[model samples]
Target chain A: MRSGSPVYRRGAALALLVVVLIALPSVVPAFFINFVMTQTLMLGLAAATIVFLAKYGGMVSLAQFLLFGVAGFMYGNAALEAGSRGLNLGWHPWAAVAFALAVTTAAAFLLGALASRTTGLYYLMLTLVYAVIGYFVFAQITEISGPSGITSIKRPELLAAPVSLYYTALGLSVLAYLGFRALGRTAFGLALQGMRDDPVRMASLGFNVPLHRTLAFTLGGFVAGLGGLVNVWWNGQIDPASIGIGPTLILLIIAVIGGVSYFEGAWLGAFVYVAMSTYLRDLPLIDRIGITEARFNTVIGAIVLLIMVLSPQGLAGIADRLRRRPTRPRRPAAGSADETEAAIRRAQLIDE
Target chain B: MTATRRRLPVLAAAAVAAAAAVWVLFLATDTPAGTVLDEPGAFVVTALDAVTFAGLLFVAASGFTLIFGLMRTVNMAHGSLFLLAAYVAVGVQQAMVGKTRNIDASEVGIADWLVPMLAGATAAAVVGTVIQQVFLQWNEGQELRQALITLAITVVLADQMLREFGGLAQRMVWPGAVTHFITIFGQRYATTRLFMLGVAVVIGVLLWLWLNRTRLGMVVRAGVDDRQMVRGLGINIRLVFAVVFFAGAFLAGVGGVLGASFAGAAPGTDGAWLLNSLVVVIIGGLGSIKGAAAGSLLYGTVVAFSPAYLPSQYSFYAIILTFGLLALVLAVRPYGLYGRPA
Candidate 1:
């Protein structure tokens, strides 16, 4: 797979992408670079958690936001000022974050243990039930979640500035993406992919389907937790509303819109979702149509419907198709050459 | 182990009740609050209210589970449909009340209530038909895709309802004759609730008879059991599916009207109802009328009694316990009490 100029081309492309992102703040408006990109990257991380499980584990869990919300609440309660909306642990930032991660991991594992026994719609419902329950549980506990929300979360010293925080999100997301890519190449990852395609066959091949799925779910939860931690830091607040059905659906929409099958799709989906949400109302077309801020859901819903019907693979899928289009013409000759090589090797082995 | 597994839900339910009993006992002695147990007369009243509320919740959840059982598609927008129906019912009721100026303002006649109920049911059924035909039919068997599509539909519908109806909460004013309070077990309770309970029972019985005896109901059950086989038998499966969808949606509309008659309808009610029905369906076996009934009773009892017994500060414990019950049920009987494992 790495035998030619394509590897170098890919490396150069990656380098250029990184350079553009780093230089984006200076080139573009601060609002677009900071508000848009920073928020979008954090959201993308959350969506990436969904995409990871959907792509590799074939489990479409609706509880990703639950993990995000749990971690966010933990951070908010521990790190935010005491006597505010929620519990005031007033722990150090690192200590609070460590606690958040631990709680999130345990919650994810427990949820996974319950959910992994089922498949398809049952699994969907199980996770959805968890999400709904999680929302209510968190919302109702006024002492922990507060009546309004936990607010006034101070960012850490090193990543307080919007630009620096953006960089941190980008760097963390890049690391996560690389980690996922590496994971996907390992034996366990290969087994997961195989299980996703045909779980019965994988099981027949001596794989522990439920355990693998649970592990994948745990990893997905961690990814989502990280996203939540960053998101809480970015927003400087955590609310029950942030973890409810609306946000969960938004995350799902973004993941599906960007292309649930690809890692890069999460970023693309988050970009589109953030852009549409933040900028769609100001569009001239909407203004001409007299679309108010209240009616934005109609537009978003219509977009979701259209995208689901016309291009279920989302924007990433479209990009993938475009990229593959140029290479399609040479596919037959390359396939024939490989076929001949395989035939010659087989014949030589038979003769021997 | 298998026998224990089968009995786990019942056991868990019993355990929950016992725990609740113990908590109420503690509250009665330890807590200095206005709990129902403190005033003995309130217990019966609370139980009655819970039963009535559960009756309405059951109507909505039965429809939800029916559609799912037959089609394997969760109607994510069932709550929106419920809310829409409530708005329609209220709209019709207001129109009638406006026309009847000669009559007393508080006294709503039978026509006012009946016509609105029919209107709401029809509107919801029509919407369900359109949804099934326009979007869902094409994506048959793609549960996730269909669910997403329905979610979008719900969002659109919910927004439209908000735009049209505004954000105000409106309750249906029942006929004045039936709205009065009556003594039940030495406690005064709204007669309208008793009427609602009776209506729910009648509807439940009718639904059962229709499913077991009527030709269409039999087809629906058959379709639920095996859609492909029914299709192979030369039955017009599409028509059956559309009909089932309409019936399910129609039930939701009926429940909405009933709900709004007392509880009132508002912007967030759709989400609340959707979650309520989903929880009920989860607790009761999905797709079973009996299961829906059982779930509603338990849910209604918990919701009703919690607010009555718990302190105002800890009222949200009801929601927590409801889902906790759900978790317990899932651990015991994953497919629900009556639901077959697919």
Candidate 2:
């Protein structure tokens, strides 16, 4: 019950955050809420899938974005009228959403089963190849996606209003954040972390390492699918460009910049990314430096490089360090040293 | 049991090869309806085309594999380096001729080709060295982090190249000597492609000699096998890494120049080349020069021949076939044909 307890402080901060998010539409301009905030939440949720794999499962997959795109494409294909381009089974909106999620989850499960055979850099490359292959397939499949991709899929009435959509995105984000946090403490989560540390040891302990990894990846895919569902609703379209290399890498950049070690970092990274992409072109300094709207990627690249060099753990890591600094004097130096040693060991294990 | 397990992959590989041969023979004959090949000469020409394209792929992928083998860094920016060189070569040729108009291949001399090749290779080597020293040097052994950093570099370099060189595709003016078609096996083939094939062969031979016949090559080999042991032997591993990076980037630059003369270079060429390099290295085995060659040949053949042989209705599936080859290879041999388990 102590006011100074870390749990109490965290709880209070989370409450304030919830209240602010709930009231954000009233305070902010409609454009900000609709364009920026909603996009941030959706992208954040997508990035959260990446964070979950990287942080807990020790797998940095480039295919999460592909899954997101798949979900969006599936929904668009299933819900849109047959008159529109691409396959349109003309299912109900809710059915389409469910179908999209289920397909995405299954795809992720299959991808994980295939990719889990390898670890570290091999896994990364395999997933990247998957994304690239997915992109090419989507681009060429005119029967399913058409040349330009499916478009004009109307949002369900429940989410037609901008405010409702915004709140839905926000609610989903919160649910995902809490879900990941809680999952991280579960037996399955602990086993995944164990596999991340030492698959051999986990295997000897009777854990089916590949199955655990695949299950985790499937969970991540479902979250990404949720994000994709909102994304299509917000944008009212799905195209090849949505899952192109640029967007694929951008999602990874978001996950890394936010801090892959923490769930909240996904949202934090997404907010920064959305803000910079939306406003960097308008900045006087950017204009002076000759960075046009098209060259915003350069700015983002520079920022990501800076983040990697200066704070490898990302903005969240930097925040954590700053928050812990004031309390460091009271804690034993051995504790910090031990933490660093553990981190080093974890990195080495991952490299193996 | 262990011996049986060890023999399994070889058996699988042989089976795959046999299946591929059967498929090729099936395509070569008139058994399939609407076959593109009316004569055996056409098939020979297509096969030659596939091999030449593979030559370009090997040139591009060799450096990537070399870099990956030594430093364990994926070097995603490798494709950007290729595109950069292509653009630079094009610029140099454009500037030297002092004309924006398309220069005929016959009008250009040795210097026209030589100068751009030198300039492009030099530029790419310098950039590669800078990347290794400035960005990658501080973060050694952290392969994933290094990969992300290179990815960032790719974004910046790709954007900058787009800014400097317009989005339109451009190609180099080939030297007059290699512009004509040469008769091979009673079929006309582009001499430029034959020249490319020759270049790839020469480069491969030189690389083989460098790796086997020289002390530096031995060090590189040892470093690839066990970097820590090499370092512990009092070798300056960082310098070796830098040299490998330079050579690898130089090879990519050469590939760019050669590729520009053949397929041309464009905005999205970086991603395409990157994908090609990835597939080649993955199939051939990462960090193995021989694997790259084998993988490139397989990949190039599939890409070139599939479209021609596939029915007109399903021609687009050729791309899928190329990727399917990768999937098949991965399923049989996870580390790749020539790759050792990390």
Candidate 3:
């Protein structure tokens, strides 16, 4: 993924990162492993969807949660449950998951078709309106989600335990990250970036801009669908609050704060979000200031504003700066080495 | 002249047809199994309620539209400003109570109400100006970032307001004389609504005159059309923008004060009013005074009638219906009725 001495360093970093993540459960406290990491993975997937669309499609979709919600609702409807609500079909867990994924992907494709026709602010507004409409439809229709919520979902044997569930979620997220990386190396991904830069030019170059955008949106939706599965499984219940603007905004805050320019920023942002929400409210200083959990949004909002103003590229940008720091001061390398190393450095930046 | 003359009959016929359809729908859906004229009278009550609601909404939404048209920035914090103003009104009224020991605020003189209203408006205007100067001015051309910044401001403001105001719903007490109910079609209605309606008309006329007849209004209109030209022409565009923002915020404050007198102020009022104002501006045509007025009336009427005419279970559908209408309008006319395509 890199060249020269830096290549070894990056490889070492990647290996370290992998080791840390895999051993996190055993190394960290149960609270951190069970709650923080689990949330970070799931929420990261959702945020990554935003990052994908924004980075490649140049569109900010506020309705990504609709896909998540649709999947959750489908899972709720099909999964095993008690009570006379009759909303649940009590299907096999695998079957329910499949059905939810299929429906969510299809719905996302349709929404993508409608939304991709617009650009800029109109697209943002359209997606926002759609999300609001989706919220109302899901909330008002008691038969779908039930009056209260759908609970007591049957998890498959492999995914029954919390630790196992966390691992499964982590595996899926890693697979998704790898899949996205693979996609980014493809011709379609290159064309998608070209489209984001200038749609008219891409269209002139024989790219179907709308189709490209729709495909990206669909891919993003699929990733979000996976997150929805993890989310529903973790909670063992689904409700409007899970899919509403509040949580959606939280995801947006995470994505933006982490930095949308890079895909890994999604996970980084989610980690910060989960950590802040999990830990910030209990702090003595915050408690003394009377900032209860109810007023938690204030802290998140302030952080978002600070990040937007100070570093729109977010934590990823900061990480990048730190990575590039040592290289910048070592400009006294031999002239021949500099000439040969230029292309490799450029390749490294793009690959990362 | 000939075209205008020819349009009169068509307009009249369309009006008649619309009225007939409304009457038919009202008779079919709203009439209870036992009541005859009660439902029809209730329609009048709802209509009045709608008009009053439209009046208050117009004040807030027109300001929102004005800011958007001129600056090309969607101020998400407008709702927070409205809520802030409402809280200010409530605070002012409470302070009045402390000074005069007036347990029954409705018995107080007109100055008691006027001072609070003025304070709310002034506070909102000052805050709006500060926001424009401090936060919005740097990111003038970037719409999405600016919108997010405003959202952040909104969230922060909302939290602070919630902390200070607590979760309770606070209402401004209107003068006792205007608070009295009058019988209209056997339905008791407050005279305060009539007063509010009068205020709306006066504000509308004043705004029209300001925009059309005044130098600043002319400059604002010009700026909306071409900001660069206004800047190049040696006009103080920044000052004009600041003034317009102040006026817009002042109107929101007025709306908050007026609404608090009837609807009361609560924690989520900012989000609700922001959504309502967005719908109004989107429907009415962004940046158009007449459009804001029309959109507000339609939205208000829908909100008022849906709850009254539709089954109680579907009462919440009023918001959905308004949104659906906006969607339809947007689908057909993406720029809104009066809005120009970008």
By TM-score, who's the top model here?
Answer: 2
Separate clash counts for every candidate: 0, 0, 0
Q: Candidate 1 residues A201-308, lDDT tens each?
A: 666678887788888999889888988888888888888888888788788888888877778888988999899889988888777786878888888888888878
Off by over 4 Å in 2: A1-4, A326-352, B1-20, B27-39, B182-188
Writing each residue's lDDT as its tens digit, candidate 3 over A231-335 gives: 888887777756765666677788888887677888999999999889987788877876789888888899889877776667886787677876553211111
Q: After superposition, how far is residue B131 of candidate 2 from its true place, in Å?
A: 0.9
Candidate 1 regions with alpha-carbon error over 4 angstroms: A1-12, A200-208, A325-352, B1-17, B21-28, B31-40, B99-105, B309-313
Provide the lDDT at B87 for model 2. Answer: 90
Checking candidate 1 for backbone clashes, the offending pairs are none
- Looking only at chain A, give the TM-score of model 1 against the true structure: 0.89
Query: Residue A54, candidate 2: how far off, in angstroms?
Result: 0.4
Instruction: Return the lDDT, model 1, position B86.
Output: 92
Tell me which of candidates 1 and 2 scores higher on TM-score.
2
Task: Report, for every candidate in turn, its global Cα lDDT versus the true structure.
Answer: 0.80, 0.84, 0.76
> What DockQ score does model 1 reach against the true complex?
0.27
Q: In candidate 3, what are the lDDT values of residues B5-55, reduced to their tens digit?
A: 546645664674476456535454533211225355666777788998899
Q: What is residue B219's positional error in candidate 1, in angstroms?
A: 1.0
